[model samples]
Target: MIDETIEEIREMQTHSSSVVAVKATRALAELTERDYATVEEFERDLERNVGALKRANPSHASLYNALQDVLHSVQGEADDLDEARELTVATIDRVVETVETGKRRAAQQAAATIEDGQTFLTHDYSSTVMEAVELAVADGAELTAYVTEARPRFLGRKFARELAAIDAVEPHLMVDGATGMFLPKCDRVIIGMDCIVEETLYNRIGTFPLVAAANEVGVPVTVVGSGAKVVDDGFRFENEIRSPSEVMLEPVEGIELENPAYDATPVDLIDEVITDEGVLEY
Candidate 1:
């Protein structure tokens, strides 16, 4: 089960990074259930598995942080293997709870920034941004959302469908290239990030250009996510290169095809990052 979850995360089968972190952390808890001859043996296995999980998706700071919390707890001095195992399980539960709670609070902060009768341009699929829109609407704010196609995956289709379910949001679906064409009509550009490492926002492939266009049009850009995504030093961000088949079912004879899973957007282009703590002015 642990190996399966790791593969799911590496393959991007999990939609949200927060969900990825939770699932990865819970998978490590499975390790605690196994029989170990000594506390040292259990700690050894834990470290090995933690390294593998982090390698599955290095761009996921939440996953890295969650696993780090568990590893740190288990590595502490314990009376016996049983004590170490119990501590590991407890740490996993605490980390998962924190990730979920932080996400909800961040969404609330983002929603508070939404004013009634405002239009937003969002790229890709972001559960944080989606929840913010829903919360704002529930509070009686009418909103309009323009979502991009987010090509190679069409994640935006999922975003648009969810927005359409809300009674007060007007959802518009457009190709990724049409961002500039519609930016003039948008009041803000709201999105989510995989991680913020070294002050750079790593997100969906088209996010950099979208944010750049939004900045050019003088529209404020807000990134909504948990603070766990703000990675400190020692964690590296690696963008996954997907299969070319995702971009084209049948490749042209001589043309080279490249499919990058994410892109880095400079922090200067963003107006603020709203997390569980509050809005962070960059």
Candidate 2:
């Protein structure tokens, strides 16, 4: 059952964005409800399952961190299966609550940075970024958003649709390659991060080039995400390589296709990272 749950998580992470940590925490909670003869058995199985999940998606540090919180929650308190189960559920609640609260706080901080009549450029689809923009519009900032049609998935199109639905903002969908052409006219760049390792922000594959273009044009770039996405020093975060079929459906003779799902952006290109705690200047 634990193995099956881990497989579900793997499938979910492949198609979803930024919700892997919350899903993993809930999966662990489900494990705790199952019947276990001994506490040792439960711990052993939990560790093995979490190890499998970590192997499945190494780019997301939040999964490992959330599972670790669950494991530590019952370290000395679980004398029986019921105690262990309760502790696991409690940990899941705390982790989810903390993540949601942090996102809300980060969104508010990000929104505060927006100015009236400014044109903001964004890439890919990020719930945190959307929330921040929504809050800024609510605050009476009449803004224009230049959204990239992030390729392979076109998640940015979805983001553009959401932004267009808002009455206070105007949204324009542009091809990813047009970033260089548009950056010079934009006031600022707002993006979302998948993980923060040291001084680098890992996000959608096109983000690095977008940041470079923004930098070349002297446009300030801000990243909005939860503090939980930050990784410890010396921890390595792998970039997930997606299937080439996502980029091309037909077979090409002797031609190779590369489809990297994410890319890394150095801190020098970023002006600020807004988190629940506050705005972190880079």
Q: Against the true structure, what is every candidate's RMSD?
A: 1.1, 1.9
TM-score of each: 0.97, 0.93
lDDT of 2 by residue, 46-95 (tens): 77767776776777777767767776776677888887878777888998
- What candidate 2 gets wrong by more than 4 Å, as runs, is 1-17
lDDT by residue for model 1 over 1-282, one digit each (tens)? 789998898778896899999999999978878988988888999999999999988878888888988888779667898888788878888999999999999999999999999999999999999999989999999999999989989999999999999889999999999999999999999999899997799999999999998888899999999998997687888888888999999999998999999999999999999999888898
lDDT of 1: 0.91
Off by over 4 Å in 1: none
Model 2, position 182: C-alpha lDDT score: 89
Top TM-score prediction, candidate number: 1
What is the total number of backbone clashes in candidate 1?
A: 0
Worst 10 residues of 1 by lDDT: 73-82
Question: Largest lDDT belongs to which candidate?
Answer: 1
